[model samples]
Target chain A: MKRNLAQVVLSTVALLIVLSAFLPDTDGGFSGIVKSADSYFPIWFSIIAVFAFVLGASSLIGSHVRKIKDRETDWQYSVVTVLSFAIVLIVGLAKLGGASGLEGDVSDPASVLGRIFSSVLSPLHATLFSLLAFYMASAAFRSFRIRSLETTVLLVSASIIIIGRLPFASKLFSFLPDALQWLRPDKLSLWMLLVPNTAGQRAVLITVSLGVIAVALKYILGMSRDMFGGQK
Target chain B: MSSDSLLLLITLVVIAAAMLRHRDRKSEVDCIPEIEVAVRKAAELNRPAYFIPGSRDIDNIQTISALSMLKVVARYCAEYDVELIIPVSKSMVMERAREVCNAAYEEAGFSDRWSSSQVSYTTDDPLGFVAHVDGMIARAKPAVCFMFGFFAGESLLLAESSYNVAEVTIAGTAVPSQIPFFVASCDTTLIGEEFFAASAMLSGNQEDIAMLQGLDAGKQLAIGIILAVVVLSYLTLIFKPEMYESFLTIVDNLLHGGGR
Candidate 1:
């Protein structure tokens, strides 16, 4: 009974806030509340978000510590996690290598934090993210077969885009008139991205919007319990 | 209202009428009990629910939608004591998700049942994220997988792995390219606009439904504007080329503030 009442009150308050944000100036009195709420939302969100991180970090650290204490399997991973965490924390906190150029400061490049981030962490992070290019290429190679009509169109479009973007393709197709010039792989590629692509994107946006609304309604009305472990 | 506005209004009514008529076909599984039964079967078989928030940062709309849905999952899971394993790539997203999941547990009055172990984050590497999630599916063997978000190439790998594992996967995303892979590998897939609608549908707020109705209005406005432009251009080409010349001028001046 208490929880249900609380839910009712919270839901009502949330609905009011949403309405005030969207419905525009209904009455004169609402303007102040709307303006103040807008101003407070970001600050509140930031505060909540900062605390959330603290909670997550604590949870992460706590779990690892427990594992290490219990001598859980492959406990060396926890040490690595803690060491990496400390390295990043020290680097960011000390503000190493910042060009702001505050001289003779402990937070300067003279510190170990500065050296680790500048010499190791930054490069490692970049290297990890950069591996996406190779992975993307590999994934595309495996998945982009001409298995269906859609796949065929995708392959052709991708090929045109690739060829058209090259200078040689433009030079080879230069004999065509300006209006008819788009027949070149590059121009056709540009046309594909700019026109049919945008239209298709809009269509998708419409369809997705309909689906999301339906799902959200199901959730809000308690018709769906996947969130509560599919409970009644 | 002007003729343009009138025409747009008419189109919207038609679209709304069509949507209402078509709502029954919205889901393959009509009864709530069936959905519950499916979820139960997955649980009984120890299938993992593959939860993906897309390949973007926490701020992305698709990611937000995913997180919102995950909140629902957390609530239900805690109530029924179903374990959820989320393997996310982005640290910021992990932090936000932890908050959302925790809040959901609190809302469901099952905070004690919720644990950080239920939701985890992998490296910021997309492939690494996929690997970790796949590992969870193997170890935990969740019954259902819910993937909602933006995805690039890795979408197929995740979905196909889940399919091979025989887990029932429900996927939705705003990206068109990822839709096909999800459709092929997952049982039910929400694509494009439906992806957006799924979030609001889960919310079950009347105003959101109205706002969705507003989107159809927005679409109708686009079509009307397109038709007007075409008709005006044709008329100018045949009867008065000079008059058609001013049409572009008016639109440019009005739309772009004459670039002054």
Candidate 2:
């Protein structure tokens, strides 16, 4: 009975939200009521989200603590995690450094929280982000292998696009004859991106949009029970 | 009504009709072979399987789709007695994931095997979360990794890291920019709409299949309209040049809800 009630509430809210998007906005009438409700819904969502952040923070701490307690593999990392989390939380809450008070900004440049974010977290973020370049290079090497006709086509197209985007692509092919000038890397790359690439992208977008609509409809109609932990 | 609203209404009507038609009919869904293979491989290797539900929070549709797929993946893991690890960026996702996984385990009669630790909350910072996951993947060396959700620049990073350690890496995302990265790095990739369709296809539920059919029908309708407009525009430009401007105006108004 509780599940039924929850489903009913969810479905009604979902349906109303969908309907509200289609309804016109006016100063008075049914559309006005919907417009008002739609406006307030986001504020409610933000309130709930604030509470969710607390849940997430607790979950993070709990998981790390459990790992430390159980002596799980790489438990040493959990110690670092907990220590960093505590330091950051305390420093931010106490508003340490630079205009220290309740009115002070936690992220003020001179604040300890600000220093941690800039000095420690920033570098760590940059290090992880920098690894992407190397990973992309390795991934590209593997993907460019000519194992089949499809891969061969991919290899050729990728090479053209890469070379075409170079600053001197047109000049690199300037020695070619007039007729062959059309084969300039820059021109070819532009055609590849603007024509075939755009067409393929549009097709994917359209299909994906339809799929999204289907999924949203399924939820609004209460057909997707799996998401709510019910059997399909 | 606006053009956007009209299109949505049409889609809703078509889906409703399809649902009614397939209400009593049982339909077959061609399941992705990688899902079972990945779970079985983990079981055989006695290693955990990692499922990343994406970097986005729970509000995104892609994340919701990813969670739906998680239920199925968790069930398989439970049945095979393999540990399923899920690292989430959002707290709500963590909560929802725990619930879905527990329910899946219960349904599989392995309720005792379920644990909240399986669904951990990493940082909400995108790169920070990626760093955490990368370290986890490197350390645990899971047999198989499944990444399904919304992703940005970190897509290739995660896929490549998984590819190095795992025997098989399967990924899916609706993000167009990230699709090429998954295609290049993962053993199996579900592109665009396929990711959204996966859970329903895996379930093989009659209503789900009906919804998919409705989606396909809507696509056909969209294609027909596009083709008609293209042909009509060309005809007007060639045979009735003076009316071409008016034709474009009409098309724009019809498509964009202009002149409101």
Candidate 3:
């Protein structure tokens, strides 16, 4: 009985949103009424999302607290977690770093929170994100193995891309034949990306888009709800 | 949408439903079994199983699909007494993840063993969430890792790091851009539509399986429709240029939000 009610609610909301897509907005009347269903619902969804942020924060807090109580390995990190949360919460709420003391925006560049974020958080974020390059290089080493025919093709394609896309490649590889002048690394690489890569991605995109529609239909009809941890 | 696109959608949906009711199709996706193996491995080792739903909020359907897979993993973990850790980007998803795991455990008669803390929200920032999960990967050293959903930016970095740490890492995403990275780094990778298939296949429910078949039917119908449209459109343009021009204008208005 409960599950059936849930299904009815789910289907109704989904159908309403889907209908709103076809309804055009017009000045005051049924169109306005229909269009607002599409427009206003997102605001409500966003509000729910904002509330969920609290639930997420509390879950993080509870887990960290358990880590502290259990003295789990790396429990000390939990202290850092708790402290950071408290500091960020207090500083932002009180606007401690604001130029106008508590009166100014917490995000004002001159404010303490802003300066701390600028000086500390931003660089830390940059450094971590930068590590991705090294990680990618490593993963590429494993991925670019020349064992199979497919891998060999991939290696050749990647090599052409790397050489072509790099600056000063034309200068370095300037000894090419006149007939092969169009084989400039950049031009060839661009052709490879624009042609094959785009074609392949587009093909997949077409397939995936259709799949999304079907999967969405299944969801709206409540056929796949059981997979989402709900009982039939 | 334009009339043609709407026609395509309706055609595909009808075809898919017909296929489901009539066809006996089966999934040939390689990663599906690999995911099963990973779950069983985690059970044997009694190590934690980490499921990263995505870096997106619950508003994203990929995140919801990830939850479906999480239910499968949670049930296996409950059955085998393996630890299941689900780290999501949104708090709302965290709530759903907890409910899924708790329900799975209850069904398995292991409700006492299920902890809501197992599903957590690390951070709202994409890379920040990646950093926390990376930390968990290093410290907990989970036996298996399941990376599934719509990933961007940090997908490769997480895949590489997970590849280095876990005994089995199976990654699936419908995003074409990320599929290559997953294929290269993970032990098993489900590319594009295969990730969608995983959702239906994991359940082993006949209706879900039928939907999977339906998706294929839709794809086939779309191909035929596109081919016929292209031929008819060009033939019209060649034989009746003025009519073709008018048709193009009509299509443009219908498709480009100008008709309103």
Candidate 4:
């Protein structure tokens, strides 16, 4: 009974908050609550979220240490994890290479931490991101096969976008009129991005909103055991 | 707002109410069947489940949706003491997943069982992350597997690895391109919007369903308004292009008024 009552109250409050997302602000209905909730929740969530970082690092260390203790195979991976973690942690926390005069905060641009981040960490991150091109190229080669009607459509779309986005494609199609040129790879790419992509994206967004509301409702109503580790 | 706009809103609201009323307790499955069973079985098996928070940055909506679904899944794991392994390809995402999972455990009153080690950050390499996740799956040998979130080629690699290991998989996301691999490999799959709807449908709350119903209402309203405009414009084009000119006039007037 108590659980049910609590569920009802929580659900009501949650529904109101979600309701605020849609309620027209011009009417001043639930907009004030929405504004205040938005303002406050981020700060609160952020505070709680910081703990997660600590917990995550600790957990990472704990797991790696366990592997070392247990002599788990691929223990070297754990070593790399710990070493990399320690390097980043120490560089940032110890204020290494900090200015001799004002030598406390390591976040200082000239500090050792900053230098390492700028020269090493930043590049490493970017280098990792650049791998997407390689992965994408590989994925394209493999998945962009002419298999079926749908696959053919995908292949065509992919070709159009790839060709249109590249300068070489534009030059290839440069013989056409201005309007045709606009439909060149570059322009077609933009049109694809703006038209079909946006339309699909918008539809997805609406569906997502509904999903969020549904999940929230399930959580509140206690009908869904996925939240509680049970069956409906 | 014009009378037309007001009418649109009214129509949307009415449709939303109807859809909400019509919503059933069970999910609406279009393609894959037994997804709920797979998800539950994965949870009930009391083993570590792997989560890939997509191979994209935090700005990706698919990643956000994946995390949201993770929230629900994490809560279940917490309640059941099921272990979860989230192999992430982004540092920021690794950080966010930790928070989300922690909150899930906290909410479930299983904070004591919540260990950071359970959700560790793998390298940002997509293939590397896939390898790490696959390794974890092998080591832990999860009973049921869920591959939700933004993914690319790595998705197939992950799913294929799971299938090779004979793990039951349920996958969902909006990326149409990856749907085939998931369909082939996963036990049950949620396509496109259904992936987004999983959290809500799984929740089974009336108000939440009502909101989803409301979205359908909004979509119907959009369709109707579009149809009306097209028909009206077509007729004007045929009979009186001059009358059709007033349509642009109203738009211009609205634009001018809004600017003021």
Candidate 5:
């Protein structure tokens, strides 16, 4: 009984959203409802997300507590995790430090939370994100191995692009004949990026957008509700 | 209905009809072999299968796609009794994920075995999620990892880390920019539309595959129309230059809100 009710509500809400997407916006009463739903649902999602944030914090804390209690291997890591979570939560919630006296946007540079974000979170994110270059290089090593024509082309394109984008490439190619200098790394990279690369990206984007549309259709029709724990 | 919505509705109807008409036929999805192999390997190794539904929230299309893909993963894992580790970046996804996993298990007559611990809400931060998954890969050492949904720069970061741990890695996403990274790092990479096709085929429902086939037909038609327009546009530029201007204007108008 509970399952059936859940399915009904799920399908009904989904169908409404789908219908609302197609509804024309006007001053009429029906359009008003659609517009309101379109406006209001995201607000509800935000509210739910805020509550879910609390739920997630609790889960993380619980896991760390379990680890600390059980004296799990390298449990000190758990202590740090829990401490960091607590500190950030408290500092942000209480608006401790920086711009605490401000009427709005208390997370100004003066607040401890704001400073931590700038000093700690920002750096950590940047450091972890910087791992992309290393990962890219590693991936390139495998991808650029000239086992086939495709890899050879890829390697050449990548090398040209890399060299072209570098600060020294223009100077490096300055010795070339003025006419032939157009084949310099920068020009070649620009042409490649503007023409072939842009075209390829556009194709991918279109294909992916169409795929998303089909998926959205399935979702709207409720044919894919098995994922929602509804009938298969 | 809006014009775009009407077109979509028509496409769905066409796809549904095709699905019903061709229910007996098999649709070729290249990822079938790898998905089957990965599922089997995870089951055999008695290791968990991890499904990361990208870093995006539920508002993103890729997350919705990823969640649908997870239903298949959940069902397969439940049947084999191999643990499925669903590490979601968003808590909302975790909530829905629990319901999905429960349903999958219950459908498999394993209602008593439904557990939400296998599915976790790790963190909302993108890189933080990556860091957590990296740790999970090193420690838990899941046999196979399915990275699906929308990904950005973190795609390679997670994939490379998973490469060091997992036996097989299958990644599917709508993000074209991330496809090259996945292709280089993962064993099997489903690029763009292939991801959607794979998701459809995973249902093992002929109707679903047929619907995908129908969409493929529509896609081909769109391509044909685009090609025809391109050829005609160039021809007009060479042979009928005056007509070319008007043609481009018509095309521009249609593209902008005129057609709608």
Candidate 6:
């Protein structure tokens, strides 16, 4: 009974919001209420997100603390996690360094929070991002292995694009005859990206959009009970 | 009503019709080999399975689809009495994931095996979350890892890390740019709409199958319209070039609220 009530309420709200999005803004009466709801929904989400942050912080701290208590493998690392988390939380909330009070900006360059973000967090983020380059190389190596026709095609296309984008590609291709000039790596690469790549991407995009519409309809209609932890 | 609104209404009507038609029908989604392989490997190895329902929060549709897949995965794990670890970047997702997993286990008659601690909240910072997960992957060395949802640059990093440790890594995402990375690194990759379809397929719910049918019908309708427009455009260009400008105007007005 409770699940039925929740489903009805959720479905009604979802339908109203979806209708409001398509309804003309000039419409008055019920449309006005829905339009107001549609506008305020993001703010509601933001409020919820703020509360979720606290939940997230507590979960993180609780997990790490448990690890330390259990003396799990590499439990020592939890000490750094807890310490960093506490220091950042205290510094940010207390408005430490240049920002001495609640009114002061925590983002000020002179503030400890700002320095931590810029000096510590920024570099750490960069270091992690840089790992992508190596990962990409390894991934490419695996993908480009010429075991199948598909992989061979992928390799050839990738090679063309890589060479085509080079600064000396035009000069490199100048020796080719005029009849086969269209095969120039630079032109071929541009065509591959602008035409085939775009067409494929659009095809995928359209299909995905249709799938999204189906999923949205399922949710709005309360057909997806499992999502709500209700019995199918 | 606007054309776009009319189109949406038509779509809804078509989907409703399909749902009604399939209401009493039992439909089955084809087996996704990767899901089976991952589950079997985990059960065999006697190691926990790890699932990342994307880096996003529960609000995103992709994450919701990922959760649906998680329901199936959790059910399989529970039936096999294997543990499943889900580390989420968002607390809301953690909550939803726990509920989904708990429900799955209960449904599988393994409620005693379900625990909220299976789904934990990590940092929300994308890379920080990835770092934490990478560490978990290294330490736990799960038998199989399922990465499904919307992802960014972290997709490759996470997939590769899991690939290195886990016997099987199955990934699905609608992000075009990240699909290649998953394809390269993971044992199985579901690309584009396949990810969404896979979730629906795995659930094997009549409504979901009906929805898939409706989507196909809609796609067919769209293709017909596009083909008609293309043919019309060519005919006009060849036989009635002067009418082309008016044709463009009419199409523009029909598509957008142009000439209003």
Q: Backbone collision count in every prediction?
A: 57, 0, 5, 9, 3, 0
Q: How close is candidate 6 to the true structure, as a TM-score?
A: 0.94
Interface RMSD of 1: 6.9
Looking at candidate 4 chain A, the ten consecutive residues that score lowest on lDDT are A223-232
Give the Å error, residue A149, model 2. 1.7
Which docking band does candidate 3 fall into?
medium
How far in Å is the alpha carbon of B34 misplaced in model 3?
0.7
Tens digits of per-residue lDDT, candidate 6, A127-207, equal 999999999999899889999999999999999999999999888878889999989999999999999999888888877
Q: What's the best-to-worst order under lDDT? A: 2, 6, 5, 3, 4, 1
Quote the lDDT for B23 in model 3. 38
Candidate 5 whole-model C-alpha lDDT, 0 to 1: 0.80
Candidate 4 at A31: error in angstroms?
6.8
- The Cα error of candidate 5 at residue A102, in Å, is 11
CAPRI classification of candidate 1: incorrect
Off by over 4 Å in 4: A1-34, A94-106, A166-198, A209-232, B1-20, B23-31, B34-49, B53-85, B88-145, B150-171, B174-191, B198-215, B235-260
Itemize residue pairs with steric clashes in candidate 3: A97-A111, A97-A112, A164-A185, A164-A186, B16-B214
Q: lDDT tens digits, residues A99-205, model 5?
A: 44446465677778779989998999999999889888898899888989988999999999999999888887788998898899998999999999999898888
Q: Pick by DockQ: which candidate is best?
A: 2
Comparison by DockQ, 4 against 5, better one: 5
lDDT by residue (A7-66, candidate 4, tens digit) is 676567655654555555553445776756645655765676566556546656788999
Q: Of the pair 2 and 3, which is ahead by lDDT?
A: 2
Tens digit per residue, CA lDDT, model 1, A57-78: 6666777788789988757877
Residue-level lDDT of model 1, residues B139-223, one tens digit each, is 5556777788989877876776666565577888888778867865676787776666555555444433444554465566556
lDDT of 2 by residue, A1-232 (tens): 6667777877877777887878877868988887787788779878998899999999888888988999998899999999989988888888888677767887898888889889998998888889889998999999999999989999999999999999889897899999899799999999999999999898888888888888877776767676566754
- Model 5 scores a TM of 0.86
Q: In what order do the candidates fall by DockQ, top score first?
A: 2, 6, 3, 5, 1, 4
Model 4 steric clash pairs: A164-A185, A164-A186, A165-A185, A213-B208, A214-B200, A215-B200, A217-B205, A218-B203, A218-B205
